[model samples]
Structures are given as C-alpha cells and as structure tokens.
Target: MVETMRRRGSSKGRALDLIRSQGPISRVELAEITGLTQATISNLVRELLADGVVSETGRGESSGGKPRMRLEINPASRFGVGVDLGADSSTFVVADLAGTIIGRLGIDGPGALGPADYVRRMADDLAHLLDGLDIDRAAVVGLGIAAPGPIDREAGVIVGAPSLAAWSEFPLTAELSRLTGFSCVLDNDATAAALGEFWLGATEVGSTYASVYMGTGIGAGIVFDGTVYRGSRSNVGELGHVSVDARGPECPCGNRGCVELYAGPHAVIARAREAAASGGIDLEFTGVAAADFAAVAEAAITGHPLALALIEDSAEYLAEAIVSLVNIIDLDHLVLAGSAFEKVGAIYVRTIQHIVGERALSRHLQHVSVRMSVNGTDAAALGAATMVLQEQLSPRSLQSVTLA
Candidate 1:
C-alpha cells in the first residue's frame, strides 16, 4: 500500500514537473513528453487542478474539431528557499513556484562565527525575510543550502570547508531543518550554481556544460546531459586543487601550485600588493579582499597598466586551468560566476575564450564558448532554491519517493 501511494505521488510529481517546464501544454502534449497514457495524464491533471497545483491557462489551437485546454503550474501554490554559505558571506533567497526570486538577504563574512551561532543567525534571518515578504509559512516546501565542499551530503554533514573550518562535521542540514521546521537539502556551491543555471539560465534541457564558480576559492560543476555529475560520495568537481605547477608553493591540499593559489581573489590581491610595493603605486582600499579585488578590477577596467597586468596574469592562470578542464570534460560551454567574477568577469571570460579556442583538444572540431553567468553573483543562492524544486518536483525515477 505504501509502495502504491509512493508511485501515485511520483506520477503526480512528474506531471507537475512537465507542466512547470513545458507549459502551457495540452494533456496530449504532456502524455507525449511523459510517455504516460492519456487517461493517466488526465487523472494527474485533474488532481493537480483540484489541489491548486495547476490551472488551465487557455485554449490551444485545435487540429480538427475541439480546442484543447492548456495547463500550467500555479505560481503561488508553493515556495522554496535557497542559502549560499560562502567564505566571505552568506546569501538567502526565496523563490516562488515559477522559480522567481521574491526576497533576498545577505550576511557578510559570516564564516568567522561558530557553527551554532551561524545557524541561529541564519534561522533568524530566514524568519525575518519570510515575515517581511508576508508569505505564508505553510506554503514553503523546503530549503536548499549551497555550501563549500567537501560535504557528506547523504549524511547531511559538512565534512570540512577550506574557508569555514569550524563547520567541519557539523550536522548542518539536520540543524537547519530543526530550526526552520522545513526539510532541507545541501550541495556544494559550485554544483548548486550549475543547477541554478540549468533551471533559471537560458540553457536548454539536456545540454552539457561546466560552470566554474569563483568565491573564496575555485571549483567547477559539471553538468552532463542535464544532470549534475556528482561522483561517488557526491564530492566531485574540486577544480581548484588541481595541480598546475609541480614546483610552486604547496597548497593546503598537499599539492604544489594549485590553481586557487594563482587564480583566486586572494592570490590576485597578494600579487597586486607586491607589485604596488615594488612599483610605488598607492593601493588604497578597505582590508576586505572582495572590496580590494573590486578596486583592482575597476583599475584594470580603466586601463591601469599595473592593475591590467595583475588581472591579465591571474586570468592567464585561470585560462590554463580551464583549458585543461575543457579538454578532460569535452565541454563546449563554460560559465564564470560568483562574487569574485562580479566585476572582473569580462577579463577572465575573454582570456579563457582565447586560450580555449587555441588549446582545447576538441577545438578543431568545435569552438568552445565561455561567458559570464546570466544570474550573476546570486547564481549559487538561486541554485540552492532550485535544488529544492528539482528534488521535490522532478525526481528521475517514477518508483522513487521522498517526503518533502
């Protein structure tokens, strides 16, 4: 009996997902896409309309006699929350059923706080955000968290974050669920960004690509044929620690010349400071690395030779790393996103495109395209919210069921 109920839920969820993605579509079209019988589609659509999950948008053109009624998701039926916990800051966003961001909040450099304090603060912030929006608490389906890796996602523990050491082995998901009274899902920030792009960006379904997310560190998220390529243990795509120079400075990951050392924001700022000291250039800015990087980016954009050189050099190293990644993954499209790329993304995009065009293994057969994220710095947070939508509404197997 439980299995039968689960199957019914799965079928209903699949129908809802189809409508969300390909609506306003007719019952015949839904059947065609889902490979379900017309009767099953009718039954599902009826249940959805009765439950306020879907609605008849309008009539579609008829082939011969009767006009078909089209169906679409009712955007106000449910909501999802996404949180991006970065090294320097954390972002919270609330998205409605149609994947629209309705509310957003941020806390700068929250990693300095202990785990318990951070979680409490996050819960409080979430409450404030929902309350300010005047949204019904019962309407929220789930919350999705985008945090740094390596994370034990199945166990709902953050094994360790290079930026937030105090969060190691923390039961983040369970704690957030307990505090918010909503089921939560956790994923690496980069992977979440990829999912965000898939759901909200202009990419078509079933297209393969890579998204390189630059925050306090660098990581890549690989999407193949529309699904994130999470390796065994759900901790794949640690592109930063990939060794680029065998004889360079040793990284905390025990590798020499990891890409993060040369291409990350801190590395760029450190190099800029050194150049400023030697060349007698006054590098004035607040102590925050993100702000300082922004200063450098503005200088580079304004054609300051020293600033341009520093940014170009960092871009070169990043390009080299991306070339290797594209060659290995055989990806044709790449997205550069995160707080680090918020200002200087164009430089990185241009440099990476030039190198990949000349160096990628498949360059002879196809031109690789590199571009900035359409969702901008909020991609990870929005992706976190989409994660909840995907898990609760778009399960891959019809036999699998999860309590939301």
Candidate 2:
C-alpha cells in the first residue's frame, strides 16, 4: 500500500520478510538467516530504519558481549485494507505492519448481483468502514481483495470462476482502485488465507504447508519459505475443481465429479434440503448458502442423524481431494479455514485426518497435522489484508498514494 510501492526479489525485501517472520531478531540473526555479511545486513537495516519500516524492540540476552538490540516491524508505520467477497458476506479489515487487525467489518455477500453492482456496493461499505475506524487514513497504503478464482492477478479480474460467473472478465482491481482512490490488488481467497496464516497465524517459518479453505467453493493456498506460491495462472489453489470421477455431475469449471460438486457447502446444503423435503430431519433453511450450511453443521453437532450423515459425506468427499493434495504437494501441515468449517469443523477434520493418515503417500515419511485456522471465518479476509504488508515489506517504488 505505501503509495504504490512494489518491491520483490530484492535483498532489502528479503531482509524485511525475515524481520516480519522472525523478529524481534537482531542484525546478526538476520545476516545468519539470509547468509548476507554483517556489513550488508547493517546497510539494509539502516535503509529500513530510515524508511520507518522497523524499530528496535528491546535488548536481547547477552551471549558474551553487551546485549544485542532486538528488532521488529514497526506496527504503526503502515496499514492495509483487505476485503473478502464471499457468496454469503463480504469481510473488510485494516491491519498494520505487525499483522494485527485494528478494525473489521462484515456485510451482505454478492448474492445474485453482477460485478458492477457488487463492486459498487462493496466500495460504499469500505468507505463507511474506514470512516469509523480510529486509524490514520494517510497511513493506509493499499487495498487487497480475496475472492473466488481463477483470477488474473496480473490483470486484476476474475477469469473463469464458475461460482462468480457474472464477475468473469471484469476488471475489479481497476474499478475498486478508481472508486476508493487506493491502489488495489487481488488474489484467490484460499491463497490469501494461506498468506494470512503466514503473515499472522502461528506457523513454523520455512515449513512447507497448505491451507484448505471452504467458502462458496473449496480451494487451497500453499506457502513454502514464507512466500505464497503462484502457479502459472496466479491461481495455484483450485482444489475444488479437481475431478474425482470422470462420469459424475459436471461442474461449471468444465469438469465432472469435481470435489466441490460433491462436498462444497452448496452441495451439502442441497442434500440437507432434499432430506427435509422427504419428511426427514428438518433443519432451518435460509436462502443464504453460508447460513444454511451452518444450520446443517449445527444439526449434525447436536446428533441429527441425517445432518450428521450429510456433513460426514461431505467430509469423506473432501478427504479424497485432500489426500491427493497431500501427495501432490507433500504437505505436512494443513489448516481448515473459511465459513463452512466454523460449526462442524471437527467432523471434517476427523474424516480428513483418518483418510489422509491412512491413504496419503507421505504417511510413511511424515504425519500430516490437520487443524482449524485460529482466524476461523476471518482467515481469508485477514490474509487479504496481509497482502499489503507483504508488498510494503519489499517495495520497489516510492510513489505516494491517496485515498478518497
């Protein structure tokens, strides 16, 4: 955000990424981690200090000589905006350099609106949200969006997301930037969740892991050595679209028997509603997919046989996709993130654990740890905000940006 700055793959950027991940650390530790000489580390640290990007937190314990000055990201130096556009609701958050969310807001989701209407309403909500949070608007650098994919991250538009069909080919970043007067960037929600986990969630640095997110559709985001991996399409984590059966129901993403077809919130809710229609265990139905799915999960948790069966069925289907993901990425840690997991996450976790534990190819080499995101439903939104922190930590330019 810091006024249109984007620095990547630079020595200074590397130093900053390390500082955020591994600080209150010392320059000596930075040098050791980066393998840069002490002199070079001092130079980079000086530049960062001059930019107000870092500060000395305190003195660390002495080994032999005087205590070393501990360093960390200056939380007050910059702030970022993150917006998660979901089928049920949109989440907005503002986070500072240290990865703490200072403010958050949630509003109705896209529903049936086309891109134009949705973006217009979203921008209005964002303006309202910022006006109320007690933060310096001038300190806000840029905006980040977490949305359904496959997105053209370079182009700032949804390319071919079946769930967001109306948004395909729409230049969301350009329009949002114009409306808010803040430079904007967009990424897949699941990918953003993974990065959010990296930026704010407690995870081992340099460890290879993946976050499987279930929102309107299922997806995943992978991180290795603290950077989110963007495949050729900048849409690396479309796990939902992965086909499990060649002859099953066709998905809008041009596949048959996709994971989402059998296991996504929409499918699970549809199944629950069908059971209710047949004089089965009735659960409350809301037109909103996320809310309705939550009802089903709640029913399952409370011992409704039909609800439990439906949720477990979704879990089993997801395990098939996830076991394959474990083998493909060789992932050792997995986070279940997003709205669908909030109510009955343990069921999905239990099912996935059993399947992955027994069927994963890497089961012999390592054990996969399955857990829920501490951020819960806010994972994608928080991850969206952290995108700004990532950009500022490695900025390449110094242009000033203004907000409306």
Candidate 2 residue-wise lDDT, 203-303, digit = tens: 77657789999997999988765666778777887899888898999887778999998999999989888998998977779788888998898899999
Residue by residue across 1-404, what tens digits does model 1's lDDT show?
Answer: 99988887778888887788788999998888888899999998999899787999889988897999999989888888999987677899998888889999998766468888889889999999999999998888899999889898888878867787788998999999999999999888898888888776457566669889988788888887676787777788888888889999998877899998988888988888887878745678676777888888888888888888888888899888988998888896899889888878888999999999998989999988899988789988998898887787666521111212
- For all predicted structures, in order, the TM-scores are 0.94, 0.92
Worst 10 residues of 2 by lDDT: 395-404
What is the alpha-carbon lDDT of model 1 when measured against the actual structure?
Answer: 0.84
Query: Residue 80 in candidate 1 has what lDDT?
Result: 88
Error of 1 at 396 (Å): 2.8
